[model samples]
Target: MNTKQKVKYKKNSKKKMNWITDHLFLFPTILFFLIFILYPILYNIMLSFKKMDVSNFMTGGVWAGLANYQAIFSDPLLYKALLNSFIFTFACIVIEFIIGFALALLFRQKFPGVNFMRGLILVVWMLPSVVVGVLYKWIMAGDSGVLNFVLTQVGLIEENILWVSSEQFALIAVTAANIWHGIPFYMIILLGGLSTLPRDLYEAAKIDGANGWKSFLKITLPLMKPTVLVLLMLGLINSFKVFDLIYVMTGGGPLDATTVIPYYAYKLSFLQFNFGEGGAVSGIMLILVIILAIVYLKLMQKEEAN
Candidate 1:
C-alpha cells in the first residue's frame, strides 16, 4: 500500500482498538444492568399483560391483553392500597422532614457529646428494616408491650391499646415505626446540607437585625431548597416502596389497613398466587416512581441552571 494509505489504515485500526477497549471496560456494568434491572422490568411488563398463575408462570402465560390492569383498576382493595400508600408516604416524609430538620438544627450547635450523640442517632437508620420492624412490633404489642405499659403508668391510657392488630391503628403503627426508622436518614442528609450553608450569611442577617426565625426563613430554607427537594423525592420513593418493615410489623393485616402498594403486590403475587395482577401493581408503582424521578431530574436541572 501507499504510505498515506498505510498511515490511514493504522489510524483506523487504532480507533477500532480504542472503541473496543472502552466498550470492554463498560461490558460488565452493561451486562449487569441488562440482566438484573432491564430484563426483569421488561419481563414484568410482559407478565402484566398476561394471565399467569403459579401453574402458568413457568411457561409463557396466555396473553390477556389489559385484563390484569382492568382487574386491578376495578378492585376496591387496589384503591384502598393506593390510599394507604399515599397516606403512609405523606406522613413519613412530612414527619421525618420536620423531626429530622429539628434534629439537624440541634446537632449543628457545638456542645459536649454532640459528636457521640450524632453517631448514636444513626443506630436506628443502620439497623436492618426487618430488625426495626420486629423490634417495633414487640414494643407496640398489645398485652405486654412497652408502649402500653409506659402509657398506662403515665396515666395516658386506661387499657392496653392494640397498636398493630387493631384496624384503626395498624396503619398508624406501621407509619410510626417507619418514621422512627427513617428519621436518622433525613437528619443526616439535612445536617449535611445545613453544614454547607455560608456562615457569613447568618452573621450578615444578625447584623441586619434578622432574628433566628426570619434568618431561617429568608436564608437557610432558600439556600437549602435543592437539598430539600432531593431529600423529599428520595424519601417519597423510599416510603412508597416500603414492604419489609410493614410485612414484618403488621403483615398488612387487621383487615388490610396497612396494605400499601408494595405489600399488596406481594400479597397478590405470593399469597394469592396471582402473578399477573401482582405484575400490574408493580408496573403501576414503577411508572409512579419513574414519573417522580423525572420530576426530580427536572428540578435538579432547573436548580443547576439557577
Candidate 2:
C-alpha cells in the first residue's frame, strides 16, 4: 500500500479499536440494566397477558390476551386500591412538603444547637420503614397504646380509639407515620435549594422595603421552583410505592382500608398465587408512574426553555 493509504488504514483501525474499547467498558452496566430492569419489566408485561398461577408460572402459561386486564378493571378492589394509593400519596407529600419547608426555613437562620436539632430530626427519617411501622403500631395500639393513654389523660377523648384496627383511622395512622418518615428528606432537599439562593436578592428586597413574607413569595418560591418540582415528583413516586410500613402496621386490614396498589399486587401474586392478576395490577401502577414521570420531564423541559 502507498504511504498515505497505509496511514489512513492505521487511523481507521485505531478509531475502531477505541470504539470497541469504549463499548466494552459500558457493557457491564448495559448488561446489568438489561438483566435486572428491562427483562423483569418486559417479562411482567408478558405475564400480565397470560393466565398464570403458581402451578403454571414455570411452564409459560396459557395466553389469556387481555383477560387479566379485563378482570382487574372490573374488580372493585382495584378502584379501592387506587383511591387508597392516591389518598396516601397526596397526604404524605402535602404534609411532608409543608412541614419540611417550614423546617428548612427555620433551620436556615443561625441559632444555637440548630445543626444538632437538624441531625436529630434526620434520625427519624433514616430509620427503616419497617421499624417505624412497628414503633407506631405499638404507640397507636388501642387499649395500652401511648397515644390513647396520653389523649385520655389530656381529656382529648374519654375512650381509647382504635387507630390501626379501625377502617376510619387506619389510613390516617399510616399516612401520619409516612409523613414523619418523609419530612426530613424534604427538609434536607429544600435546605440545599435554599442555600443556593443569592443572598444579595434578599438584601435588595429588604432595601426595597420588602418584608420576610414578601421576599419569600417573590424570590424564594420562584427560584426554588425547579428544586420543588423535582422533590415533589420524587415524593409522589415514593409515597405511591409504600408497602412495608402499611403491611407491618395494618396488613391491609380493617377491611382493606390501607391496601394500596403495591400491597394489592402483593396480595394477588404472593398471597393468592394469582401471578397474572398481580402482574396486571403492577402494570397499571407502572403506567401511572410513567405518566407522572413524563409530566415531570415536560415541566423540566419547559423550565429549561424559559
Candidate 3:
C-alpha cells in the first residue's frame, strides 16, 4: 500500500470497471436472444420427444423417446413433400438468379427513369408473401383468369388451364409466384456486388481487345463468386421455410403437391393436432439449416482469408 502499490491497484480497479461497462452493453441483446430464439428452439426439440398433442400440450406429456421421428420417417407423405420442396426451391433459385442478374446488369447502366424503374421493381419484393400469393392465385384461376384468356387468344391451348387446382400445375404455379417475389432480392444483392468491381480491371480488359462476354466471364464472375454463394445460401434457406405463400396460394395443394416441409409441419400441428410430429419436423429442418449455415460461415472465412 505504498505509492507505487497504490497506483497499481487503482489502475487494476479501473480496468475491471471498464471491462464490466463494455460487457454491460451486450447484456440486453444476449438476454433477448436467450429468452426468445434459444428458448423456443430448445422447447421445440424437447417437444419432439414427447407424446403430446392439444390434449396434453398444456400439461406436457410423457417422454416418447424418438417415436415422433420414427413416425416421420415411416410416412410416405413426408418423402413426397420433401421432393416437392426440393423441386420448388431449385426452380425458384435458378429462374430468379437468371432474371435478377439480367435485371441488375440492366439497371446498373445509366438510362432514363432507371432509378424509378429499380424502385418500382422492389415493390414486388417488399410485398408480404400472403398478398403475392393471393394476387397470383387470382391470376391463375381456371375459368376466367387473365392468364388463361391470354393463352387461349395466343393459341397456346384450346382451353383454360387449371393452374392452382390441378395437381400437374399447382406446384409450378406456386414456384412461379415465388420466383417473381424473390427476384428483387437477388437483383439488389448482385447489383451491390457488381457496383464494387474495380473499373480499372474492365478498362484493362477492354484495352486487351476483350469483348463484353469475355470481360464478364473473366472479371465479373470471378469477383462476384462470394456474393453469389451467400445469396444462393440465403435463398435456399428461405425457400425451404416457405409456408405462408403456399398456404395462401394452394393450401398445401390439390394433392400435397406444393406441401413443403414448413407447411407439412403446420398441417401436422394445427390441422391434425399432432404437435409431437410437427415439432419433430421443425427439429429436422432446423438441423438442415444449421448445417448449411455452418458451411456458409466456413466459406466466408475462407474467402476472407484469401
Candidate 4:
C-alpha cells in the first residue's frame, strides 16, 4: 500500500483499539452483575409464580398461578409486618432529618475538635451494618444493657424495661437502633449539601432582619429541598429493607411485632421453606420501591418546571 493508504489504515486501527480498551474494563463488572443480580431477580420473578417448597426440590417447581400472592394477602402476619415497616420507616426518617440537619449545621461551624468529631462520625458510617446491629443488640439487652443501666442510674425508672420484648416497644426499639446507625450517613450527605449552599443567602437574610429560625425556615429549607427529598427517598428505602438489626435483636419476636417486610421474606424463604411466598414478597417490595421512585421523579420534574 502507498504511504497515505498506510496512514489511513493506522488511524482506523487506532480508533478501533481505543474503543476496545475503553469498554474492556466494563466487561467483568457487567458480566458479574448480570450473573449475580439480574439472573437472581429474574429467577425470583419466576419463582413468585411457581409452587416451590421443600418437597419438590428434585422435581421442577410447579406452577402455582396466583396462589402465592393470594396466600400473602390472606396472611394476618403480612399486615402486621407491613404496618411495622411503615411505622419504623416514618419515625426513623423524621428523626434522622431533624438530628442530621442539626448535626450538619453544627459541623458547618468552626469549633474545637470539629474535625475529629466529623472523622469519628464518618467512622461510624464506615462500620459494617452487621457490626452496628450486633452492638445495638448488646446495648438493648434487658439485664445488662447500657441503656437500662443509664436510665436506672438517673432514676428514670424503678427497673430495667424490656426494650425489645413487647409488641408496644419492639417497633420503636428497632427504629431507634436504625436511627443511631443511620444518622451519620444523613449528617455526611446533608453536610455536603450545606457546603454547596451559598453563604450569601444567609448573609442577605440576616441583613433583611430575618432571625436565625426564620432564615432557616424560609431560605435554608427551600434551598435544601432537593437534597432533603433525595435523602428522604433513600432513607425510606433503606429503612424499609432493614433486616440485620431486627433479626439480630428481636428475630421478629414479641408476637411478630418487629417483623418488617424483609425479615418476613427471610422467614418465609429460609425458616418456612416457602420460596414462592418469599419471592412474591420480594416482587411486591420491588414494585413499591419503583412506585416511590416514579413519584419522586414526577415531583422533582414539577418543581423544576415551576
lDDT (tens digit, per residue) of candidate 1 on 245-275:
9999999999999999999999999999999
RMSD of 3: 1.6
Superposition TM-score, candidate 3 onto the true structure: 0.95
lDDT against the true structure, each candidate: 0.96, 0.96, 0.94, 0.89
- Per-residue alpha-carbon lDDT of model 3 for 1-306, expressed as tens digits? 699999999999999999999889989999999999999999999999998887888888779999999999999989998899899999999999999999989999999999999999999999999999999999999997889999999999998899999999999999999999999999999999999999999999999999999998999998999999999999999888989999999999798988899999999999999999999999999998999999999999998899
Backbone-clash count (model 2): 0
What is the C-alpha lDDT profile of model 4 across 1-306, one tens digit per residue?
Answer: 999999999999999999999889889999999999999989888999998989995685899988999999999989988988899899999998889999999999998999999999888878777788788878877889998999999999888888878777777778888898889989998999999989898999899999999988998888888898899889989888988888888899889989989998999999999989999999888888999999999988987887
The lowest-lDDT stretch of 10 consecutive residues in candidate 1 is: 54-63
Candidate 2 residue-wise lDDT, 59-105, digit = tens: 98899999999999999999999999999999999999999999999
Model 3, runs deviating above 4 Å: 1-10, 301-306
Better of 1 and 2 by TM-score: 2
lDDT of 1: 0.96
Return the lDDT, model 4, position 17.
97
TM-score of 1: 0.94
What's the TM-score of every candidate structure? 0.94, 0.95, 0.95, 0.93
